[model samples]
Target chain A: MNTTTKAEKTEKFAEHLDQANIQGRGVSPLTKLDPNLTVREAYQVQLLTIQKQLEAGQKIVGKKIGLTSVAMQNLLGVDQPDYGHLLNGMVIENGEEISFHKVLQPKVEAEIAFVLKKDLAGPRVTEMDVLQATDYVLPALEIVDSRIADWNIKLQDTIADNASSGLYVLGGKPLSIDKLDLAQVGMVLYKNGEIMNTGVGAAALGHPATCVAWLANKLFEYGITLKAGEVILSGALSAAISGEPGDHFQARFAHLGEVNVRFSNKVDQ
Target chain B: MSTVNYQSTAEFLHRAETEKKDVFRITADYPDMTIDDAYKIQEKLVAIKLGQGHRVIGPKMGLTSQAKMKQMNVEEPIYGYIFDYMVVPEGGALSMQELIHPKVEAEIAFVLGKDIEGPGMTGAQVLAATEYVVPALEIIDSRYENFKFTLPDVIADNASSSRVVIGNRVTDPAGLELDLVGVTLSINGEIKDFGAGAAVVGHPANSIAMLANMLARKGEKLKAGDVILSGAVTGAVMLSVGDTVSAKLDGLGEVSFKVIE
Candidate 1:
C-alpha cells in the first residue's frame, strides 16, 4: 500500500525517472515502492515526469499506445492498455545510427505512424472522426525502452515510467488513410536483408486509425487533446525484436514504401 | 560425482552431435549438476562450434509457452545459441541420417535493428530494438535417448536445438497483434498441430525480452542483426523420414521443410 500522499509519490517517481534517463540506468519497478498504487496515481506520476521534461525544454510531439494487443495485456495481467506522451527528444530519423550508450535498455518494433493535419479532442471520438481528421500515414520504427529494471512491471509501473516510450523513426512515403484500406495494408520487416516478420493493419486493434481514436478518447479524460502535426505511433505491429550493435533493420510496407534503421557498434564514452 | 568441467561436458555433447549418436544424459552421470554448470557446458559447446567455423547467428528461447512450461514442469524459460550451420533453407530437406530424435515446432523469429544490453530489459525495449519479425520452424533433436532428460540435461544439450527454417516473408511489427497471429502446422498435407504467437510467453517479443534479461545476468547481450527464435508455439511434433512439414503463420506467411532418409 502507498505510504505517501499522491503528490509526494508523483514527485518521487518524477525524480526517479529523471535520474534513470540521465544516468542511463534503469531503476527498480515503481510498483515495488507502493504495491497499492492505482492506475490513476500512476498516470499522475507520468504526467509529473512529463512536466519535468517539458520544463527542461522538450516539446510534446505526440503520444504512443502500449499493450494494445491481447498478448501484451495478458502478460501484464491487465484488461486495458496504457498510453505515453512522446516528446521531441524522443524522435529519431530513419537510417539514423542509434548509439547504444544513450539509452538505458532499448528494443524496436514496427508501427504505422499517423501525422495529423487537424487537432482532435475527444470524449466520444470515433474511428470516422480519426479518418476525417485526415493527415498522412507512414511506416515507423519505434524504439521502446524501460526505466523499470528488467521490465518487471505492472500496468501502473509502466504508466508511471512514461509508458516506456523511448524513441521513434518516421520514414517512407506518407499516404492519406482514406486512399488505403488501413486494416489490410501489408508489412514485411527485414534485418540484414533477411525476412524477420510480417503483419497487416488489422494487427493494431483492427486498424491503426482505431488505435489513434482510442488514444484521443483516452487523452480527453485528462483534458488533453491530440494536436495537429504530431506523429502518433499506434502500437507494435508484431513482436518486438531485441537489437544489437551493427544491426540494420528495414520494414517494407505495401503502400507506404520502406523504413530503415541501423544501430552504431560504438558505444559513447 | 565431482562436478565436471564445462570443457569435458561440452566435448562429450559435441561428439554426440557431430558423430550423430545419442549419449547418456550428463545428469545421469553427474547427478548433482547445477543450472550454472549446465549453462557453462552450453557456452563451452557454443565456443567449440564457433571454433569449428560455425558463426553465431542468434539465440533461441525454449520452454517459453505455458504448454511447454507445464510439460517441462518448470516455471521459467531456457535459452541456447543458434548457429549458421543450423539453418535449413526454406523448403529444403533435412537428412534423417544426421539427427538422433528430431522434432519440429512453430515459432516467431526476431531480427534486431540495434544491440540490446540489458540488466533490466523490457518488452518495449525489445520491440524498439527489433527491425522485423518472421515466422519460423525449429527442429529440435535431443541427443539423449528416448528424448527424456532433466532441465540441466536439456540446457547442457543446447536446448535440443538442431535446425531452423525461416519463412520467406517478413513483416513490420508495428501494430501487429502478434499473440493473435494463428499458426497452422501441416505434415504430409494433414493438419498435425495448431497454435498462435501467444503460445510463446503470451507474445513472442516478451520471450526475447526474457532472453535479453536472462543473458544480461551472465554479462552477455543480444547483438544487432542477431536472429532470435522466440520459442515454440506448440508441442514438438515427432518427425520421420519422408515427412513433409509446413507451418503457416496468419499474416507472416508459411515455412515448410521435408525430412529425408
Candidate 2:
C-alpha cells in the first residue's frame, strides 16, 4: 500500500478506535465482505491505516522486539518474529496508574529500552551499527496486547495487528550502550511488590543490541528505517508475567533503576 | 592483567566433564567476556569433552519469540549446547531443583546428516542442508542461581544447557511447509498452549539459517551429521514439578515428559 493511502486509512482507523473508546466495542473480526482480503491482507491494510495515523501528528517513540524467546517461538509457531512501533503517547510512565479498561487484553514484559544517538539506517545493519547508533539503554516494561482476540493470530495477522504491541514505560538509568555490559546486566520482575521472576541481558541473543540489529535488518526487507532518537525495546529478560487491575509491577535492573507499573481498576474511557 | 589461555581453558573443561565432576566451579566473573573470547573457551571445553568421549548430539536455540524477549528484558535470542548424555527420554521425570533456574519449551528438532553454515544461506538452503526433522522437548535451565547470568555465563553453560527429549522422527519436509507446522502442548493432560512453525521467523527452517549465519559470523560452520535445533516452534511454557507435559506437532510427531520433585 502507498504511504499516502496508508496515512488516510490510518486516520480513519484511529478515528474508529477513538470512537469505539478503544475499549467498549472491542474489535470485530473482519470477514465475508472482503472476499479478496485474507486475514494477512486485512492486517497489512490495517497497518497502513495505523501508520498513517501516527505519521500525521504522533511521534514514534520506540519498537518492541518479539519471538526472541525459544518458548515464544514454539508458542507463536514462528522462528523469528517482528516488531511494532510505540508512539510517545502510548508509553505509561512507571508507577503511573493505568486502567485495565484502556486496553483490550494486555500482558506485561520486562525489557531494556534503547535510545539511539544517531540514525540507524542500512540495508546491511549489524551489531556494530546498533552500537554506533545507540545513545543509551535503560530498563523498561512493555505492555503488549493484540487487536486479534486471544492473540489467535497469523504472522500477517500480527503484522497488521500493529505487531501485537501496545504501551511501554522506561525505568532506572539510561546508560551508554558501549560502556554497559548488556549481556551481563540483570533484571527482576515484581508483581504487587513481590519478586516474580529474574533474568539477565544474556537472555537477549547474548546481547540486547543484537535484537536491534535483527529488527533493523529484518525491517529493511519491509522498507522500514529506524531513525535516530527512536527508542527500541530490545527483548525480554525472561518470559512474560501477566497482571490485572490494581496489580503493581516493578522491574529492578542490576545497574539501572527500577521501573514500576500500577494497573488501575478503571478501564480506558 | 593476565589474559586467559583458551587452549588450557578448553583442556580444563574437558577434563572436568570426563571426570564427571559436577562441582567444577567457574568464577562468577565470566559474564564480562566477549563473544569471541567466550567461543574460544567454549570450543576448547567442547573439544576436550568431544575428545574424551562425550558426544555432541545437538545445539539448542533460544529467545525465538518477541513476547519472550520482552519478558526477559532481552533484545535478541541466545544459544546453548546439548550432549548425547543430556537426552531425557520421553515420559522421563526430572527434578525442579536439579537446575538453578529452569524453563521448559517445546520445539521441532532438525537432525542434520550434512553440515550447514551461511551468511547468505536462505530457508531453502537449510532444507537442502537438513536430513530430518523431529519433535523435541527442550528444558532450558541456567546454571546461575536465581538465573543471574551474563552472556558469557550462558554461552559457557551451553546457553542454559539442560536436557532435551527427541520424539519419534519425521524424515521429510517434502509435504511440510515448515511454516504451516502446528503444535499443541499440554501439561498434565490439560491443553495449556498451541502454536505453529510459521511463527518462527515465517518458517522453522529460517531459524536454522539464523543460527548458521550467526555461526558463520564467528568463523564456524555447522558440521555434517550435527543435529541443529531449528528453534522453538511454540513459545516456552513455565514449568513446575509434578507437571507432565506433552507436545504434539501436526505432522512431525509428539514429545512428552514429566516434571518431578
Candidate 3:
C-alpha cells in the first residue's frame, strides 16, 4: 500500500516527474495527484528529480527561473515564481534540429541567458551585485515543457516538476552586460519563418537583471550559491510560443543578434 | 499606439491595391492615424496579398537617407515588403500601365548568408552574414495620389513598394569601401542623380541592420536566402515611357530596366 507520509509523497511525485520526462511524456498535474502538496514540499520533489538526473551522469550546467514575466504570471494565475536546475543534457546547440520525441508539448520562450563571472549568493543580492558578477549575456531560446498534462499546472505543480524546463539554445554573440540597458532591450520570436511573438526586457520582472538578483536571493534561502561560469536563464521576455514538428524558431534580441532552432519532424530512432 | 480596430481600413487598402489606383492617404480620413495603425493596415494588406497567391520576397527600406528623411519631414525611416511578383527580371521591362506614377531609386541590395534577428543586431553582424552585395533598382509606386503621402500613409502602402530589378553582378562586400562606393543614376543614357553609399543611412549595411532591428520589434527576422533592399543611394527619379533607367555601383556593376508605355 502507498503510504501518505511526507517523505513518501515527495518521493512518489519526484519519481512520477522523472519517469514522465524519461518517457518523453506528461502526467496529470501534481496538485491533482496530491492536493495537499505545499510550495516547500514541491521544492523537495524538484530537488529529488535533479538528484536523479545527476545520478544519471548529467551535470548541472545552470538554473532557470519561471513565471517572472507579468504575462506569464497572469497566465498561471500566480503572484510568485518558481526555479529549476538545468542539466547539461538540456543544452541544445544553436541552429540544431531538436528531436520530436525528446519533448512533451513544448513551448519556446526568448530570454537573456546570463553567464556569471563570480559567485553570487543570496540574502542581500541586489541588481548591482548581479551586474557586477555577470560576465556577459547571450540571446537564448528556451523550450519550456510541462510535465503537467495540457499545461494544467498550478504554481506548486510546476515547481515540483522542475519549473517545466526542457532544453535551451544559446546564441553565439556574447554581449557585455555594461553595454546594455536591460529594461529597454527588445525581442522578437519567429516560428516556422513567421513572426509570432514580441517583447521587451522589461517584460521579465521589469528587467532581466532584476530576475537574476531575485534568483540569487531566492537560492540563498536553500543554501545554494550560483557558481562562477554557471549559466542562469533569466526567464522569458515574451509569452511562451507553442510549436509543432518541422517548425523552426528564431529569437532575435535588439543588439543581441539572433538564435535559431528547429523541431524535427521525426521522433528519435 | 491606438489599437483601434483597423479591419475595415485594411479592407479598403486591399481594394485600392488590387485596382492599382490611387486613394487618399489613410490619415486623410482618420487624421489621428498613428504609425501603429499604418503597420496594422500594412499587415492586413500583406495578408490579403498573400491570400491572392502573391508571395513576399523580402523586406525593403524607405527614407533611409538623412536627406530623404529631412525632405519628407520624418524623423525615422519606414519599410515595406517586396512581393515575388514585384521582382522585375534583369533587362526586363517595368510596365507603366501596370503601376501608378512610378519612380526609380538606385540601391544596393544585401543577400543574407544566414538568418539574423534583432533587438541588438549590429552592423558587424549584417556585414558578416551578407553573402553578396548587388547593385539594384527599386520602382516605387504609391497608391496615394501624386505619390504624396504622410509617413503613416506610406507605411500603410507598403512603403510605396512596387517593383525591383536586381543586377547580376554578385560581389563579396569584403575589402570594398562600401560607404565610399559611388553610385550613379542614368535615365535614357544621361546622368540624372548621383550619391555615395554613405547616403544610405550613413552606410548601406547600416540600413539593413536597422531594418532587421525594426522588423524584430514586430516579431520578424531576416532569413537565409532572403534578398534585402538596403535603401536608395540618391533621390528617387521620376520615370518616363520608353525610358531606360540604369544604376551603376563602383564595384558591384550596373542594373538596368526599361519602362514601357
Candidate 4:
C-alpha cells in the first residue's frame, strides 16, 4: 500500500529537518513527510541529522532524554523515553544571550543537569548506579525548539527532530550527591522576574536518577554507553514556557543555586 | 530536653517532605520538646532552606480561629514560612503524588506595599502597608500522620506548607471592610464551609500584625514584596482525586484548583 518506504523517507526527513534548523524556521511534520515513519526509523532520521552536524564539525558531548512523564509517555504510547544527541555546539554558557532567530519557536525549560564521572553501560543499570556515576548536579535551562510547523508534532516527528533539542545552559555550582537526596530537590522557574512554574525532583519519573537509569537501559539496544565527562540534562523540572525576543529566564534550584539565559532583543534574520 | 538535637530533627522532617512520606510527630518522639526548642528547630530548618537558596515568600498563620486556639489551649497561633516553591499557579492542577495528606482552605492574602517590622506592629500599620488583598486557596499537607501536632510541632514543620494557589483578583483593603469579607468554600460544585475575615485574629490585618510581631522576635521584618496569608477563613476540607475546589470571597473573586491523582 506504500510507495516510498520508511527507510527512504528517513533520509529525506533528516535532510528536511537539518535545513529547517539551518533556515531558522519550522517546516511540516516528519510524519506528514513520510506518513508511516516508525519510531525506529525516526531515530534513524535523528542519527542522520547528527551525522550531518558531525560533518559540519560539531562534537557529540552527551545525550538528552525527553517525554519522561507518564502522561507524555501514554500520549505517545511508549513506556519509556526517547532521546536526542547533545552536541558541543548546543551548550550555551549560563546567563549568555543568544540570537532570537538562531532557532525557530524556542521554549525554555528548567531542569536538573548531571555530569557523569563514570561510564554507564546499560541493560541493568539501576538508580543507585546513576547516582554513583554522577560527578555532580547543577541547575540547567534547556531551550527546546521545534522544526515542526506550529509545533504540530507526533512522536515520530519530534523523535526525528532530535527530541526538539536546541541549546542548554548549566549552572556554575556543581554539587555532590553524598549528603543530598535527589528526590528532595526543588526548582522554581521564572520568566522576566515572574514565577512561571515550580517542581520537585520527583517530577521526573518519581526521581531524576530513575530517568538516567531508564535512559541507559533504553540506549543498550542501540549499542550506546553513556560515556563519562558528559553533561546529561535529565529532564525538565517544570513545564516549558514560551519566550519572545529579549525575554529572560532564571531557574533557581534547591542547593543547586541558579542558572539564567536570555534571548537577543532583535532578530537579525 | 528532647532526646534528638535540633539539627537532626530538622533534617529528618526535611527528608520526609522530599520523600512525600509521613512519619510520627516530632513531639511524639520528643515528649519534652518545648515551644522554644520547636522554634529552634524551625529556625534551623529555615536556615537550611535559605542556605539552599529557597526564598521565603512570607509568613502564614495557623490556629487563627479562637475556638481552635481555645481547644488547643494556645494563646498565640503557630506560624510558618512559605517558600517561593510552595506557590502553585493561580489556576492549576495539584498532583496528589507530591503530597501526603493535603487539606484545602480559603485564605485572605496581603501583599505589602511597604515593609512592616515589629514587636509592637499594629493592625492599622498592617492595613496601611497593604498594597492589595487577594484570595488564596492554600493546600496544607502535613508530613505528620493524622495532621496531629502541637503548636511547636507545626511551627517546625513550616505549618505543613505544601502548595498554595493564588487568585488573580487583587483588591485594595482600604476599599473594603476586611472583617466582614465573607468566604464560601466549595468542593465539586457543593458548598462545604463558610466564614468571614473576622474569624482570623479578630480582623485579618491583626493576624498579619501578629505574624509581624512573631518575626520581630527573630529580628526579621516583613518585606515590601512579601505576601502574607491571613490564615484560614473557613474550616479545612479534605480533597480527593477529581475534586474541583472553589472559594468565593465576598468582594474578591473566586479562586480554585483541581486535585489530580
| Each model's fraction of native contacts | 0.00, 0.00, 0.00, 0.00
Candidate 4, pairs of clashing residues: none
lDDT for each residue of candidate 3 in A1-269, tens digit (9 for 90 to 100): 34467778888988887777677777888888778888988999999889877887989989999998666787878886678999899999999999988898999998999999999999889999999999999999999998877888888999998899989999958889776677646566778865554555656776788888998999988889999999999988767889799999997666677899999988665
Question: How far off is residue A262 in model 1, in Å?
Answer: 1.3
Which ranges of candidate 1 are over 4 A from the true structure?
A1-4, B1-261
Least accurate 10 contiguous residues by lDDT in model 4 chain A: A194-203
Q: What is the lDDT of residue A39 in candidate 2?
A: 40
C-alpha lDDT of residue A240 in model 4:
80
Task: Evaluate every candidate with DockQ and list the scores.
Answer: 0.03, 0.02, 0.02, 0.03
Q: What is the lDDT for B134 in model 3?
A: 93
Docking quality level of the chain pair in candidate 3: incorrect
User: Which residue pairs in candidate 3 collide?
Assistant: A253-B118, A253-B119, A253-B120, A254-B118, A254-B119, A254-B120, A255-B119, A255-B120, A255-B121, A256-B120
**Where does the lowest 10-residue lDDT sum fall in candidate 1 chain B?**
B190-199
Give per-residue CA lDDT, model 4, range B190-261, as digits (tens): 656655566676678999999889889979889897888989877788889999998877667789989999
Model 1 C-alpha lDDT per residue in residues B179-223, reported as the tens digit of each score: 656566679976555555666776788899999989998899999
Here, model 1's chain A TM-score works out at 0.95
Report the C-alpha displacement of residue B256, candidate 4, in angstroms.
Answer: 23
Per-residue lDDT over A109-149 for candidate 2, one digit per residue giving the tens place of the 0 to 100 score: 88889998887765778988888888888889988776755
**How many residue-pair clashes does candidate 1 contain?**
40
* Residue B116 accuracy (lDDT) in model 4: 94
